[model samples]
Target chain A: MYENKRLGLLYCLPFVIGVALFKLFPFAMSFALSFTQFDLIEPPKYIGLENYREMMTTDKLFPKSLGVTLMFVALTVPLRLAAALMVAQVLNFKLKGINFFRSAFYLPSILGGSIAVSILWRFVFAKNGLVNQAMTALGAEPIMWLGDENYSMWTIVTLNVWQFGSSMVIFLAALQNVPTSLYEAAAMDGAGKTTVFFRITVPLITPVIFFNLIMQTVHAFQEFNGPYMVTEGGPLHSTYLLSLYIYDQSFKLFNLGYGTALSWVLFALVATLSAVAFYSSKYWVYYAGEKERS
Target chain B: MMSSLIRSMVAMGVIALALGSTVVSGQELRFSWWGGGERHEAFLKAIKLFEAKNPGVKIKAEYTGFQGYQERLTTQIAGKSEPDIMQVNWAWVSAFSKSGDGFYDLRKSASVMKLNEFTDNDLALGTINGKLNAVPVGFAARMFFWNKGALDKAGVAIPKTWDEMFAAGKALRAKAGTKAYLIDGEGYDMILMSHAYVYQKYGTPYVDPKTGKIAMSAAALKEWASIYKRFQDEHVATPLPLRASLGGVEKPTEQQPDWVAGNWTGNYTWDSVIRLRGSTLPGKGSELDVGDFLTLPGAKNSGVFGRPVHMYAVSKRSKHPEIGAKFIDFMMTDPEAIRVLDLSRGIPSTAIAFKQLLKEDRLRPLEVKAYARIATLNRNNAITPPAAQFEHPRMQKFMREVFEQVGYGKINADEAAKMLNEQGSTILQRL
Candidate 1:
């Protein structure tokens, strides 16, 4: 037993080394950098709490960017997870070309971080673009989807939610694992489709939903490319997210110290939010073959 | 398994050593610049010519699109892995040349090349704190490019002053009936032109020399912002949404000489854009006429509307500072380099190269005209340096936002002015 445990650890050595080097080392370094004023050229100067203090008090754009990012996260996460669940439920139906539909829906998730999709997004939402042209064809006024501050955030949110395939696939797998006997017994009791879905299907998939919600929430908060490429945090800084702001400061303005500080703040916020989500999941999440120990 | 791993590691070490030796063996220089495909091709051709002349030096050309070049360059600099020869913008001079010894002092290197060959202003732009840090390749000034055919069709005369320009725009709009406007409502360039006009009228640049800060004169800000607001209100400029759809007048053909091809009027841009337009949109039935850089009426000196656009700076930590300085000198003075580069990097700054190109008839007509115009303007006026804080990306973002706000009519002139004062200072301080 001891030999087996040693072998297991030996086999996991590569992963352990990778985690230490790539993740832990960088995390610690970034934390250290947060305390210093480094421009990446001259030696880093230790200026304790200056970056954080400035960000908290003096940085006019920080609060605005933080608010915008939070607003985006708030709008996107629940909507995206719910949409994914709905689609997964539908895909779970014993329909023709199920494999094809699944693949087609899953394609966007695969292409989510790709440059091609972002370019396509730009074209789709650009003024006189596909969306506006469609609106015109429908005898409605063409909205300035990207150009107007009012509608630009929605454009980004829609882009985020549109790639719901990853969560959908997970939900689909979870639905397949859901016991067929429960649904059968419910049907025999003259339970309607809606009743079965709400009572049986939903409870069984709650764990997966919870998993997806946390992941998507974290992802939504770190949303950078959509806003960076499409609106460029513009139309009066409406789409400026914290990540984009950090990037601008570090790379564009060469303020590595302040950028690091902003990054740490973002990390803390995500960590706290994730903790809260995990804590809340205990109440709603349900796993198969588990008693109500709580 | 351990033996196999050892074998693989040995092989990897051998490969790494081989690659390192190969890189060290060659007189390799990594040259970086940001431009489009044509510019890349031209640069490659120039590199090939240089390599053929000096067989030992092998030039490795690196290029990127202009959008995020500065950011990428900064990262490379911070990482202590900057390219040997970099095409740096002039705005970066003050920031990059932080200390006197940060970049290669060109004056102390390369006896073959002489600095006296280039224009005084061009040479001066490269000099940070009396040390020649970089070499200027070209000069470009923001000016108006009018479509003669469109103006003729509209039967409107070119305006001499701001008020006249407004009246002409209104007349053109009235005549064309929503199909045309005098200029694109994209941000800042025209406003800068307007600022220059006011500066010429007042004989004070945007920055006050005495205070060593931005001369945000309330009157000047109000006048400039009000004029911009008025331009929007009069429909002389395209609405924000329309302008946004056009993608800043440079991207869409319908907005360019095509707008002229379709019978609209003039646009404002640096002169090189005219050459680009002429070549790209050949035989578009539109002729580009270089208009005078507008001066405010009754001005003491019509201040020259030019900035030191771009300079070639050696990295402070360059492994081969002498080699970098030599390359810059070659770029500035070499006849072969001059022929290969042509006016692609705007008009040549060197008087010898300028004369050589002029005699050879290699200089573009547009470039010649631009140089002449700049020279004429320079006789009476001095070049104004951009505000140091304004060089920051935050300031650019702030300006872009305020411009959008003003363009979209979200806030009036008063609100924009206030935001500019507050946000502009904040960005500066943050930097």
Candidate 2:
């Protein structure tokens, strides 16, 4: 046991050092910077809560950006989870060329955040892009996908949903782990397919769905590259998310202190939502050995 | 596990070898600039030539696209890791040069550049606090560009004044049955042009020279916003929805392809963009023509006309300061390099380099004509410096927002004027 503990310590030393140096240090530094005025050049000067206070009261764009980001998260998270689950269910069936389909769907998620994909997104949603071409073919007026403020947000949301392959893969793995005996017992009991699915498969995969939901919601809140490359937060700033606003303030405008404050505010929001989700998970999420009590 | 350890050892060995090569005996100078692919190729070739000439000096070139050039340079400057030599924008000269000891004074070094070969105006642009902190390489001024075939098809004459331009746009739209904006006024150029016209008419620049305060009068703001509002209301411009989708400046022109297909008219752009777009358009090269710069109707005597294009500065932290200065000298004085660059860095400001390229028959014909016209006009006009607010990103964003508000019809001329007055002044004061 002592030898095993020594081996474990040796293996974990690198990881512990890495976490302390890369993650914890930066997190603590940014937390401290939230209350300071530092332009990344001069030494930082503490200004109490002035940065946060200004963001709350004086910054007109902050509330609007926060609202837009929340709306995006609200719409995209549920739709993406549903689509991913549906696709995973379809793939779980025994079919020809199923692996190829799964791989093709998963490819976009891997490339989603890349510059090449962002450029492709711009071309796909341009005024006279493929979307409009299809619309015109359908005997409808060509809608400006990226130009109008009303439609631009949908383009970003659709981009987010289109990269649901990662979550779908997770769902597929969870589905595979579901025991076959449960389905056999349901069949023996003369339950319909829908009832079997609802009572057995979905309940078994509830933990996976819960996991994917929280992860994707956090990711959606930080979506930046799509709107930045496609519309540049334009059409009268309708598509401006809090992430893009923070990036503009920090990098483009050189307001590092204010940007850090915004980041901390975002952290607080994400943490609160995650905490709520975790607290509520006990009611709905099911584990492998859990009783089927109400 | 043994193979993994061996692989790690090999990686460390390679990195150590790379680091060992960095410690060369000769003085090494690192230079960075933002440019397109062609400019990068030309610059690399010039660096090779410089290396051949200076046996003891070595240069490392770093280049990137212009999209985030300023932000990257500012970060490098802040980190105190800026390259030995940097190709800087003229607007950023104040921002970088204000750090008194953060930039090298080129005039004090014996082996540094001699500014005598450059023009008086070029030298004047590089002088800050009576010290030459940078070297001017080129000059570019905003001018009107037109698609001759489109204009001819629409049966409209090129306008020489603001009123005539508006009338011409309306006539073109009617005849073409499509939008016919004279120019898509984007970014600071539009604001600068508007300010010039207003300053000429009122006989006052945007800044008061005596007090060093912003003079963004409510009347001027209203006038500027009204012009844009009129452009939208008259069906002369494509609606806000269409214009907002157009991508970055370096991207290919959306309207140009349509203009070639006989759907739209001209745009206002730099000469380089005009040439680049014209080359790609599916028409005879002569179909595109350059238009003369227009003046507001009441501002014919506008003295606000000059623009600083781009400049080169040496970093204060450079180990090889003389090598950096030499690179700047080559950028300013080398005739072959100038011809190879050829309006990619704008027109050469040095008289000798300009004459050498002209003699070599390497100058683009349209650029030559354009430069000649600007020179003739510049001889009689006063060259006003760029506003201090131009360097502030907040001010740039505010200007863009004001345009957006006007374009979308969310606000009227008076409201935009009010917003501009309040926000613009606040931004200027903060800066």
Q: How well is each residue in B214-275 modelled by candidate 1, as lDDT tens digits?
A: 56666666565676667767866555555554333124333443364544466666665566
Q: Best candidate, DockQ-wise?
A: 2
Question: B322-413, model 2: which lDDT tens digit per residue?
Answer: 78887888877777667666656666778878888788876677778877877776675555555645545766777877877777788998
Q: Summing lDDT over every window of 10 consecutive residues in candidate 1 chain A, give the lowest-scoring window.
A: A2-11
For candidate 2, what is the TM-score?
A: 0.92
Residue B14 accuracy (lDDT) in model 2: 97
What TM-scores do the predictions have?
Answer: 0.92, 0.92
What Cα-based lDDT does every candidate model obtain? 0.75, 0.76
Model 2 chain B: lowest-lDDT 10 consecutive positions:
B247-256
Q: Write the per-residue lDDT of candidate 2 for residues A1-294, one digit (tens) a residue.
A: 876677677678789999999999989988999999876656778999999898889888999899888988998999999999989989999899999999998988999877788878877777667887888899989777776778888888888898999999999999999999989999999999889878898989999999998999899988988878877776678789899998888777877888989999999999999999999999999887777766
Off by over 4 Å in 1: A1-18, B1-15, B209-211, B239-241, B245-264, B278-286, B301-304, B359-364, B418-431
TM for chain B in all models? 0.91, 0.88
Q: What C-alpha lDDT, on a 0 to 100 scale, does residue B391 get in candidate 1?
A: 54
